[model samples]
Target: MTSRTLLRLAMAGAVVAGSLTALSVPAQAGNAPKTVPVRLLALNDFHGNLEPPTGSSGRMVDENGNTVNAGGAVYVAAHMKALRDANTIEVAQGDLIGASPLISAAFHDEPSVDFLGKIGVQVSAVGNHEFDEGYAELRRIMFGGCHPVDGCSPAGPWKGAKYDYVGANVLFKNPGEKTDVTQSLSANPQVKTLLSDWGVPALPPVSIKWMNGVPIGFIGLVTQTTPNIVTAEGIKDLKFVDEVKAANVASKILKLFGVRAQVVLVHEGDQVTPNQSPDACSAIPGAGNRIATQVDPEIDMVLSGHSHQAYLCRVKDPAGQDRLYSQGGSFGRVITQVDMQVDTKTRDIVRSSVVADNHVVTRDVDPDSDTVTFMDFWRDKISAVANKPVGRISADITNVGTATGESPLGDLIADGQLAATKTGGNAQIALMNPGGVRAPLTYLTSPASEGDGVVTYGEAFTVQPFNNLMQAVTLTGAQLKTLLEQQFPGGPNNQPFAKILQPSANLSYTYSRSAAWGSKISNIKIDGVPVTDTQSIRVAANNFLVGGGDAFAAFKEGTDVWSGPLDIDAFVAYLGQNNPIAPPATTRITAVD
Candidate 1:
């Protein structure tokens, strides 16, 4: 951390005493506890997958290949308890609910919230997905007495999470006003009034602890981009305030309360590289964007998430001063630990910097019996429908990426789109986003290897969980070329909203690695013919893309659009009609110059 970023949070000589002298408590512990040590276990985005899934790291590999299990709620509970024997705090970033298995989302966020509460998560921010059903649903899940959503009857284990869910920037139509509401921490009047108008109850911002004689405050924030990324239906009329501005507002408020040593627990992050580089943003891990660096310097430690990446970085703030910043990778794969030293007398942070290290939640240690029990209980309920085979892959649909090409799995999905859209051959090319392929075809049970196994309707829905219907549209050959080039020159980064839409197997193209944004793609072909950059091709894709979702504005330019309903259901129907269809002998998506 740089010198200027300290908020000039200078130590009170009488309060803090000596800096490093008091910080090295471990050395003089024999003299009876002089300085106290506190641990903060922060995590985020556990989307209600109670049980560990297959083919996942489930653990983090350190600098070496050694593997370690990262997390499980029960273990998280145990670890937090063990650490708190000193002065530890347990916290989460956000997205603890929504997009969860049907088991949890069915209950809105109640199950996840209650689950967090049980696991000892003391505080959290509101993730984008938390608003999947809007503020009313959030109220029902967080504060309302009963779980209004389904399967809540059993209430199995989530009982509800034990944590403070904070959303400093989540506001109503009213400005600078507190809505009539109830949450863990205290809130301003504007927040209270807004919640009342929306019929949604919200918790307060910045939970604080007065340890020794010093007060430490924690401010929670969700990404300002929530409204743009979430479904249009979920966030209607709601405003996602600017993250930096909201944080600054809160810091000033905390200042009024005479609180210092502030930490911002936000759900925003930046791209990261290990060991600090041009991309580094302070001592926090799991690198991402410059949000940590760009925010005000009053924040001592910024714990961030939402990118599901792994990085540990430290960056200098606007004043060329440094602050401690870190983020853990998504999934319960890795647990990040940041250690801070506080002065004993004043409870003021004397010599504060941080160490961002990670540990894998490995199965090697005993899985907390309660967590295992709770997880297994829900696993059975969710897997009953989730694990059921949906449809048969008549071919070896695989996404195993080789050099410079697409996978067989990518082709099969593309083919599914084309087949769904080709009522009368209206479309020739099918496109999909690589991120949408949730699971791969099981080697033996898939459609390709027939052993009296048939594709079930359930299996197909699993592949297309987004429920995007297959649609066909016509574009001029020239306009189509522009669309393909757009993916290249821009890639996913050139345009902040860009999403890589993987083409179906029926298409082939060669894109250069060196090409600039909006121009990388060069040669393209479909069905044994070279495609002109400006030439159009009839295209098939899920409703999400065809409607300009993920910022694919080109699809909107198509002259004709036709819907074939949900693609997954179409896959199931196709399997029933074509029981023995074979996988294409050649992989469809390829590269060329």
Candidate 2:
């Protein structure tokens, strides 16, 4: 059959099995003649953090709810090698690169990708952050070559990522054009390259990876909300489809190739109960759960990411049978081990025997020498610039956010942006999204100790690594209120949780959780003066936010925008001006409930 005919048949199969009713299986027929034990190791959201993360970002709650330091590619490599067996397959949920630290971002995350290859990640899901630099950059990341703009790094030309990136739900969309190509993604250069690398696009979707004579089909899907969170220009020609629909279709297609054991590496997950153990699910009811419950039963295991919460769950599929749904916490902090038993005769998984566990990448173990050597090579390459002293701090200003999402580090970043735009744009207020504050400004962290009060350029870059330019925009008091309301959950955009923005010293507001959606915020004041509806104010924020990133749609309505310095540059300059910076009080955003 032609490729088009095969595509038509696969799509038809997806429609017929979309709402499959029966997932119940008969009791082990005749004692199950032959069985194979397969071990799967998984991680997610590495974000190019080669070294150990600092403060709360590096810490993870243990099974007993006690926090402990747990991350670093060296330790991750040690753990993966220790757990590897003849039947083991290593994989990641996604966000392995984009939004990285200075060490990796300096060379465009090539070190992290190379480390992943050495550590043996066979495949990974394509995350929303993967599209941050647009499709062309992603191609470079996957297919090795010199960066199109920056030329080659000190390590010479890029060698590309070793693992395959699969996205069943990501498709090509041409503007103002109509064709049978809605589900056709072959037009995309990256997709075309992936197809050329692995033919038979439909049977097992993007690709089918095998382990020890047993085929394990992988179907990767990113959240449909990707477009809202990513830059509009980066993905204007791409479409992110429903996770459940895509996984169901992919599962049906995989079964056609007699690959009964299927695993979905999805870049979407649920938020767990705060301060709880990493293994506890605790009645979670978020997007991950919503997708988990709706996917087809043929999928044996689901590995997820994006929410960055570590969880090992057994949510019921459409057939009402429990299937493994797991996520490893971000930044290589947590690794999930899933063991499955498959029957040789039926070539299907024995769902009842499936088990999973999430292990924290504890620092107690010795670091892997090879990984350490690799990291050291890159560390030495970027040392002179990374180790330069930027400023001093009175104490540790951490990114450990409050229940209301305010953090001392976030407040400090907002202050930096406000100071940056004050002279040029006459900005009166600044807002910093909690997600942008990647790490803390730790006073005496390990791996890079620059005395108790001293801060380095590398640390500042690690904290604000997106390198987004600062912009001052004009927003009416009414529009500002709308922006604040958008910070909470259940807005027009379906943000899974509340992302309370960090505001500068002049901007203060009180919000109540008990109030209704539109009326949750009150007591809006700019420098002690109550803001009025008609009053226009100049506010400072990164280019990402002013352009409606993170579902802040009201920001897109701002008028007469004035651009300023790069976020990291402004932060460094602010640090230099305010030597011996102290942790700011978290009183700006008051919570009533």
Using TM-score as the measure, which candidate wins?
A: 2
Worst 10 residues of 1 by lDDT: 1-10
| TM, every model | 0.74, 0.88
Count of backbone collisions in candidate 1: 79
Distance from true position, residue 129, model 2, in Å?
1.5
Q: Residues 411-479, candidate 2, lDDT per residue (tens digit)?
A: 999999999999989999999989888888877844566777889999999999887889999999999
575: Cα error in model 2, Å: 0.6
lDDT tens string, model 1, 227-325? 544555545657777777667666655554456567788887765444332113433332234567666776666778777555565667677766666
